[model samples]
Target: MNKIDLTITDAFKNKVINPVYLPYLNNETRTQIYFGGSSSGKSYFLAQRAVLDVISGGHNYLIVRKVARTLSKSVFNEITKAIGFLKLTPYFTINKSDLVITCVNGYQILFAGLDDVEKIKSITPAKNVVTDIWIEEATETDYDDIKQLNKRLRGKSLVKKRLILSFNPVYQTHWIYVEYFAGKWEESKNCYSNDDLSILKTTYRDNKFLMPDDIRELENETDPYYKAVYSDGKWGVLGHVIFKNWRTEDLSEKAKPFSMFQNGLDFGYAADPAAPTHNHFDRKNMTLYILDARYCYEMTNDLLAAEIKNMIDRQVITCDCAEPKSIKELRQHGVTAIAAKKGKDSVNFGIQWLQKLQIVIHYTLKEAINEFTVYKWREDKDGNVLPEPIDKNNHIIDSIRYALENEMAIIDRPKRDRPMPKRGAL
Candidate 1:
C-alpha cells in the first residue's frame, strides 16, 4: 500500500472530517452525545477529535467500550488509524502491552474497558488526570459505568472536562435518551448543570466517506422498526412495549407534595442485576416519580441492605415475595423490610395498574428508565404480540411493582400520619 498523508489540513481537504461535527471541536459542553444511524462517521470523527485533543494542550483522552477484551480490535484500531492518518506517529510512543500511546509532549491516549474497573482506576497520566472521555458504542455500556468513568476526569488538569458519548440510538429507555432527548431530568436537581450538555444527531447522509455499496445496503433495509431507529436516528419502539402509556417529564418541586414514599427491592442471581428503587407517589394524579435507583450485580444481602440503609434508614421496603430470607435478614439489620402481596398474575396486575397512571421517572434513576424503555410484551412464535412481558430487563420494573403495592393498599384505607421511616437506624 502507498503512504497516506496524515496532516490535519490534508484530512480536512480530503473531507474525512464531517462538517456536522465542527461544533464539537470546541469545548462548549461538559457532556456531548453524538448519536445517529449506522455508517454516520461518528467513530471516525471521535477518533480524530481524540487526536486533536491530545495535541491541543494538557489533555489525555480515555477511550472506552463496555468490554475490555474487545477494545483492541475496534476502538483501539480506530484511534491508531487516525493517529497514522494524521502522520503524527513519530511524536507518540505506542505500548502494545499496555494499550497506551504516550506523546513526547507528555500527553497520552489510553484505552480501557469499563468491565475491568481496576484497570480503569489505575490509569495515571503523565501530565494530569484524564481530561476527556470518548465512549464508542455507548449503548453497550450502562449508566453506572458512565458514572465510574466520570470520576476519572479530574486531578490537576486545566483543560475543560468533557465526556463524549457516540452511539446508534438503540432503545428509548437508555439513559442517553432520557437525559438528552427526552428532557426528563432537565429540571430535577443534579450534580451537573444541564446547560453544560450538548447533543448532536447525524446520519449516513452527512458522511462523505461511506462507500456506495454500504449506503445501498442501509437504504435497502426494510424493517420498519430498525429503519426508524437505526437509519432515521429515532428512539426505538420495541414491538409492543408494556409501559407505552407512561412518559418522562419534569416533576415540578412546587407541585403538591407526594402522598406517599416507599422503597422496593428486586434481588438478582449471577450475571443478573439486583435493583432497588426509591419512589414517591402522587395519589391524586396517580403519578409516581422515581426518586432514585441502585442497580448492581452479585450484591450480598448485607451489602444491599447497607446500601438501602445509606439512602433511607428503616423505611418500609417491599421486596420480592420469594426473597423472604433476604427480607428477614434485612429486618435483622434494622431495616423495615416487608413482603409484597403476590398471587397468580401479580406481575400482570401491577403492570396494568401502572399503565393506568402517569409515571414521571427521574433521569438519575437510569435503571428504571432503561427498563421502562425496553420492557416489551412477549411475542408468540407466529410473530404476534402476547399479553405477557419478556423476562429480561425487569429488575427495576419488579422493584417498582412491589413498591406500588403500597399505592394499591391506600385505595381502601384512610389517610393518616404514619411517622416517616427512621433515619440512621441501621
Candidate 2:
C-alpha cells in the first residue's frame, strides 16, 4: 500500500454520478441491479462506484463480462474512464495488460470473463475478501455462470458482499429476468430496493450529460420493440402484440414432413437491422417452422449475402424488391436472391396469411421470438390503432411475407377465384 491518503467528498461524488444514482452510493444491499435503455449512464455511475469503492477501502471488487475479449472496451474501459473523470488517476496503479487496478489503500479491482474459468479460480484478492462482483452485460450470462460466481462470496467481510449487475434487457426469457426481475419489475418505476436487493431502471431521459445529437438519434428510432427495450428500458416488448400464434420447440427432433423449405430477406440499414430467416412450410397442416435466423446492424450487402449464404445450402431466397441494387449485389456475391412480387395492400394480405397459420419457432431463434412478441397494429398520429400492423421491428416477419408472397396472394384472392394448391415449395 502507498503512503499517501486519498479521499472523495460528497460534493465530488455528486459531481461524478448522476443525481438519480446518488442515493445508491452507500447502499448496503447484497444484490444491486441497474438496467434500462441505452445511454442511461447506469454503467457509468457503477463504474464511478467501483472507483469510489476503491477509495473507501476495506474490500476487493471484480468487474466481469460474458466474453473476456469484450471487457477491454466496455466494462474495463468504463472504470478507467470513471477513474480519470473523478481525478483519481495518480492514486491507482492500472495494469492494462492484466486489467487489474490497485488502490493506494490496499484494496484492488479485478476483471475476468465468465468464459475464463481457470483465470477466475486463480484470482484471489491479496488484501481483502472479494466484496463486490460487477457483471456487465448480465443478459449474456446464464444462471449457472452467476451461480458459480455467487459461490465466491462465501466468507464474511467488513462491507456488504454484493453482486452488482448492469445490462439492457433484450429478451424476457433470459435467466436474469426470471431470477431477479420476473413479476417484481414495473415499467413505470425507475427504482426498486428491498432488504437484500436493489433494482434500478433507467433510460436516455435520465442521462443529463448526453449530447443533443445522440438524444435526437434515439428519438428518431421508429422500431417500437427495440426502442422499448433499448431506449425506454422496458423488459420485453411493450405494445398490443399482434401474434399469440407462435410457440418455441426443438424443431429438429419433432419436425414433420414439409412441403418445402424456403428463406426470406428484408433489407434494412442504419437504425434497422438486416434480418433473414430460414423456414419450413407444411402446406397440408398450415404451419410455418422457423428453423434458423439472424439479424445484424451496420452490415453491408456483401456481408449480408455471405451471411445468408452461410445460413443456407443454396436455397432460393425471396427478398424485398424495393432495393434492386442490393438484390443485384447479393447475386454478385453468389446468393440466389429473387425479387419478391409486389402487390397492392400486400402487407395486410401477408400479415393475414401468417395469422391464418401456426408459426413454430425453434428454441434457438431469439430474434423471431422477440419480434413476434412485440409486433403490433400501427397507430395513427392521433394515437388511434389502425387496421394495419406497424412496419417497424418486423424485419424477419417482413422477410417471411416476401418469401411467401405468392402463397399470401392465394389466401388474399376470393375463395371462388383461388387456384388449386401447387404441388411444390415456393
Candidate 3:
C-alpha cells in the first residue's frame, strides 16, 4: 500500500481537526458513538476521518441523516470541505448529481438519508465492501433502521468495519442511548457485543477552534438545563424538562402590550390548578413575549372565568381542547375562550414549533417561569420519551403552546400594522 507523504499528513495533523478526536482516528470499534453539543466539531472530525479511510483504499462509506433532502447541505458539504482541507480535490472526483465522491484508488463515499429506503437499497459500492457507515443524528432513526443498515456490512473486506453514530443527547431515551449507554437491550431483543462498542462524549469546550464570541455565547447560557446538556455534554433525562431555550426577562416595564395578542387557559379543580396566559407575538422577528399569567389552585371554574375576564378580556383564548365544557363555561361567563385544535401529533408538533421560536417569559409570570423549569415529556417503563408529555408541570406550557399555535394564524396581518412601542421605549 502506498503511504500518504509526510507533507500531506501535516495538513491533517495541524489544527485541521480537533486533537480530541485524533486518538480515535483508526479506532476499530464496530460501533462508535460521538455524542455532543453544537460546535464540538464532531461531524467535522468524522468527515476528515472517513475521507482518510477512503484515501487509504479498499473502502466504501455511507453518511446519512434522517431525511435525504438535507444531505446536500450537511454531510455532503462536510466531505467536500474535508477534501479541500486535505488538498485531495485533485485525487477525488465529486459526482454532485449522485451525491457520491469517487477516488482514483477505487474508493467511493456515498451520502444518503434513511427516509428514502429505495435509494438506500440501490447503493452499490466500488470497493472490497461497504465497510463503514456514519449515521449522523442517529437519534432521529430507530432500532429497526439501524438493524437493516448493519446487514449491509457483509462480504470480504480488508479494512475494519465500523457503524459510527453521532448526535446530540437531545432525548435521553432514544434507542442509541438505550442500546449503548444504559445497556438495557435485552428485552428489546437487541444488544451490542461488549468488545465492539465505544462511546465518546464531547462538548463545545472540546473544540479549540471556536471563536471568542462563540465561547462567550456558550458560557453565557442561562438555562440550567441546556447548560448541563449542550455545554457539559451530559444526557438530559427524558420526561424531565422541555423549555431549555428560554430565560427570564423583566418585561413588566420593558414590553408594553400591543393590539396583536392572544391568550390561553387551562382549567383545573381542587389540588389541580387553573392557569391562564397572556401572550403577544412579534411576528416580524419571531419573538414571543409572555406578558402575564393567572395561576391558582382550588379555584372554581366561575372564579377562574372572572379572573380571565379581568386579566385578558375580549382577546381570543384557546384553552385545552380536551375541556370543551370548560371552554363553554368560560364563554358563558363572558370570557372569550375556545377549545384549542388538538389533532394528531399536536403535542409534539407544538413542542417542536415552540423549540424553534425565541420565547421570552416576563418576570411577572412567576408561575410560568417555575413551570418552564420543570416541564417534562412522558416516558415509558424503559425510560423512552413518549410522544406526549407528563401531565404535571405543564399547565403553563400547555397554555402557552395553545396560544402560540392558535395565534400564529394571525401572523399574516402585516407586522407594521401591529402597534409597536415608540422607537426608544424598548
Candidate 4:
C-alpha cells in the first residue's frame, strides 16, 4: 500500500494515545467513538485522522460541532493546528469561507455545525461524498439531527461510510451510548464486533501530555464533587435540581383559586412503584407547582384506590389519575379521575415541554426533585449521548412529563385582541 509521509509531533508522541486511533487512521473501521475524562487526547487523535484522510487523495471528511460558533472555536482550530504542526499546509488549500480544506491529491476536509437545520441541510454529502464524519462534543447536538446527517452521507463508493464521535460521558442514559453501544451489547449478550462499532474509553490519567502544574491543579481542587465530575469522570448528584431551584419555603395559607386541580399518574407496579404527582396550576402566576407526590410499591388496585381517596379526603388532592383500575374506582367513589394519555412519544413531548419552561415545584416534593437531578442522556458505544426511554421507574418524572404535555396547550394561548373602549376624555 502506498502511504503518504506523516510526522508525529513530540507532543502527540508523548501523549497516552489509545491504540483505537491507529485503526481509524488505517481505515480499518467505519465507525469510531472515543470517550473519557478531559485531556484524554481524543481531540488530538481525531485531528491526526482528519489530516491523514485529507492527505490520502481519495476520501473527503467532515468535522462537525454542535454550533457554528463552537466549530470556529474548537474543531476548526484543532484541525488547523494539526496541519501547521505537521507541516502539511503545502499539500492542502484551507478555504476559510466555505470551511473546506482541499488537498493537492483531491481529498477534502469540511468543517460544519449541526445546530441549525438549514445549515445541516445545505450540505449534500452526495455531491462532496464524505468518507468520514467527525462529531466533536457529540453530546451537545440533537440526536435527530445527527441521524439526518447520517442519512445524507450516501457516498459513491461501495464501502460503508464512517462516523467518528468523541466526547466525555456526561449522561449515563444518553441515546448514543445506550442505543448504539450499550443497547446492542445488552441485546446480543456478547461483545460487539468492529463491523458493529467501537467505543474507546480514555481518561485524564491516560493523557501523558498534560503539564505537571495542570495535573496538580486538577488534584488540588477544593470541591470534591467538581473534581469527581470533571477530572475523574465519576457521576454524582450536585447543584440545585431543575425543580428544586424553583421551590419556596413559605407554603402559608393563601386565597385558593377555584381552578380545576389535576393529578398525573406514572404507573410502576412492583419494584419501581407507581408515582402520582399532584400539580396545582396557578393561572395567576402562570406557574405549575408540584403540590405533592404519592409513591407506593406493589399495591393492589383496592389499596391504591384507598390511598387516592385518603389524599382527596385530606384536601391534599382534588382530582387524580392513578392506575387504570384506580381511575375507574375513583370515578365510582365520586372523585373525578382521568386516564393519562399513554405513549412513548406523548411522554417525551411532555418532558421536552417542561424542559423549555421556567418551572417551579413546591419544596415538599423532594423525590420528584431528586429524579430530575439524576436524570441524564443515555450514551452509545461510540460515545454519542441521546435521551433515554421513559419507564415506570421514573414515575414521578414521567407524571410531570404528562402534566406538562397536557397543560402546554392551555399555557401557550396567544394574547386576545381587546375591543377599544371609547377614548373617555379625548
Tell me the alpha-carbon RMSD of every candidate.
11.4, 6.7, 17.8, 19.9
On the 0 to 100 scale, the lDDT of residue 290 in model 2 is: 94
Writing each residue's lDDT as its tens digit, candidate 3 over 38-146 gives: 7888998999988888887766898887767668878899999999987788778999888999887878899888868998887878766788989997866768888
Q: Which candidate leads the pack in lDDT?
A: 2
TM-score of each: 0.56, 0.71, 0.57, 0.53
Tens-place lDDT digits, model 2, residues 1-426: 523466577887777678888988887898899999999999999999888887777768988887676687788888899989999898889999988999888889999987689999778887868999989988767678788888888677878799988999976766688889878877677888789889999899989899999999888766666667887888864555678799989988765565477789998864577888888877778888998876655679988888898988578899999999999999999999999986766776677678879999998666687678768776544445566677666989998888777665565555323332232211
Instruction: Judging by lDDT, tell me the better candidate of 3 and 4.
Output: 3
Q: Over the stretch 1-426, how does candidate 1's per-residue lDDT look in tens digits?
A: 112233466446356577777666765588887877888888888887787777755678888887675678788888888888877788678886788988777788999888788988988877778888989889877778888888887777777889888888877656667766675433222113357776767788888888999889888865555676667666676776778666655555732475458789888744677788888887887777877776755567887788788866777888898978888988888878899886656777677777778887865455567678777766555456556667877988899889888676566223222232232211
Order of candidate numbers by TM-score, starting with the best = 2, 3, 1, 4
lDDT of each: 0.74, 0.81, 0.75, 0.59
Q: How close is candidate 1 to the true structure, as a TM-score?
A: 0.56
Task: Write one digit per residue (lDDT tens) for candidate 4, span 1-426.
Answer: 224566665466334344545544555466677766677677987887678666754567777876564566577778888888766778777777778777776667887776466766666432247777888878655567578767766747533578778876554445566656654433212124566576666656766667888788777754433555557754333422223334443332431553456566665666576676766666666666666676655666566666666655423332224456666765666544566654434544555456555555555454555466454443334433344432322667776665554566576423212221222210
Q: Which window of 10 residues has the lowest lDDT sum in candidate 2?
A: 417-426
Model 1 Cα RMSD, 1 decimal: 11.4
Please report the candidate that would top TM-score against the real structure: 2
10 residues in a row with least lDDT, candidate 3: 417-426
Instruction: Score candidate 3 by TM-score against the native.
Output: 0.57
